[model samples]
Structure formats: structure tokens, C-alpha cells
Target: MKIGELSHLTGVSVRSLRHYEKKGLIASVRLPNGYRDYSPLTTETVDTIKLYLNLGLTTEQIAAFLTCVLKNKEAFCAEVLPVYRKKLADIEHQLKQLDQIKTNLIDRINSLQQEEQVKNE
Candidate 1:
């Protein structure tokens, strides 16, 4: 398919697709007519790239992943398990930190309300 069709199928913008190409995340060949022709395999490859991007993986990371795994979870585990685990661990740590912040905010609010009631009495 052409770049336009690939963009439609992938729901990725043409500019982003170009960027992906520049990043070596996806590849296409230029036709004699100056249009990019992508293979059928590119569809699934783009999906995998988008998934990794949404999961907060950088293009370099995604590229490394695609190079090693190519959508195989088992390959991902065997090749880049530490990177995936670190991403998950970073997210978990952020969630725990946010939970602590939430608790602190609630406690401060309760304390302020109590002080207000005592002052009005």
C-alpha cells in the first residue's frame, strides 16, 4: 500500500509516519512516481510501534524492541525484559508517590476544617 493508505490503516498521521521512518521504526520504499510503498507486514509493525509508544517507550527503545522481538512477547522477555520491567517499576513508583500525595492532601484538608470549626466556636 501507499503511505496514505498505510496512514489510514494505522491511524497515524503522515508526518508521524515519516518520523517513524526517520527513526528506523518503520520502512518504506520510494516508487518511481515518488510515492512510498509499504509492505503488508508494515500494518502489524505499525500497530506494534504505536502500542509501545503509548506505553511510554521511546522510539529508540521501540526500535530496539522491534529489532529483537517483532511483536513476540516471548522474544521481548528474552531480549529486553529488564527494560520492560523498569518501565513497569517506574510507573508503580509514580503511582505510590501519587497515593502518598493524595493522602497528605486529605489529611491537610481535614486538619484545616477542624481548625476552622474550633476558631468559630
Candidate 2:
């Protein structure tokens, strides 16, 4: 398919698809007419790319993962597992910080409520 079709199917902007090509995250073949021809695998590849981006992985990291996946399809899981585990650990640490913030906010609210009650009485 062409770039437009790939963009529409993936819901990624044509500009982004082009950027992906430039970033080496994806490839496009030049047709005789000078139009870029993209393969059907572009959809699957774009989907995976989007997934990694959503997970806060950097472009370089995504590229590395893609290289591994392509070179060792059957063992990609083994390679990806460590990266995901580290991400999970980071998320857990952030969650703990968020929990502390929530606790502090709740305590502040309770303190204000108590002060308001005392003022009413």
C-alpha cells in the first residue's frame, strides 16, 4: 500500500509515518514513479511501535527491541521481558510517590475540615 493507506490504517499521521522512515523505525521502498511503497507489515510494525511509545520507551529503545524481534522472532520475548520488568519497576516507584501525595492531600483536607468545624462551633 501507499503512505496514505498505511497512515489511514494505522491511524498514524502521514508525517509521522514519514518521520518513522527517517528515524529508521520503518522502511519504505521507492517505486518507479518515486512514490514510497510500504508493505502490509507496516501496519503490524506501526502497531508495535505505537505500543512501545505508549509505554514511554524512547525511540532508540524501540529500535533496539525491533532489531531483536526481527533477528530472533522466537526469542524476542526473552529479550523484551527484562526491559518491561525494568519499566514495571519504575512505574511501581512512581506509584509509591503518588500514593504518598494522595495521603498528604487527604490529611490536608481533613485538617481544613476540622478547622472549619471548629469555626462553625
lDDT of each: 0.87, 0.87
Count clashing residue pairs per candidate. Answer: 0, 0
TM-score of each: 0.80, 0.79
Error of 2 at 48 (Å): 2.0
| Runs of candidate 1 exceeding 4 Å displacement | 71-73
Q: Which stretches of candidate 2 lie over 4 Å from their true place?
A: 30-35
In candidate 2, what are the lDDT values of residues 1-121, reduced to their tens digit?
9999999999999999998898899998999999999999889889988988899877777776786676567264575777777889999999999999999999999999999999999
Checking candidate 1 for backbone clashes, the offending pairs are: none
Query: Any idea how many clashes model 1 has?
Result: 0
TM-score of candidate 1 against the unseen true structure? 0.80
> To one decimal, what is the Cα RMSD in angstroms of model 2 from the true structure?
2.5
Residues 1-121 of candidate 1 have per-residue lDDT tens digits of 9988999999999999999999998899999999999999998889988888898988887776686667466464564777788889999999999999999999999999999999999
Candidate 2 lDDT: 0.87
True lDDT of residue 76, candidate 1: 44
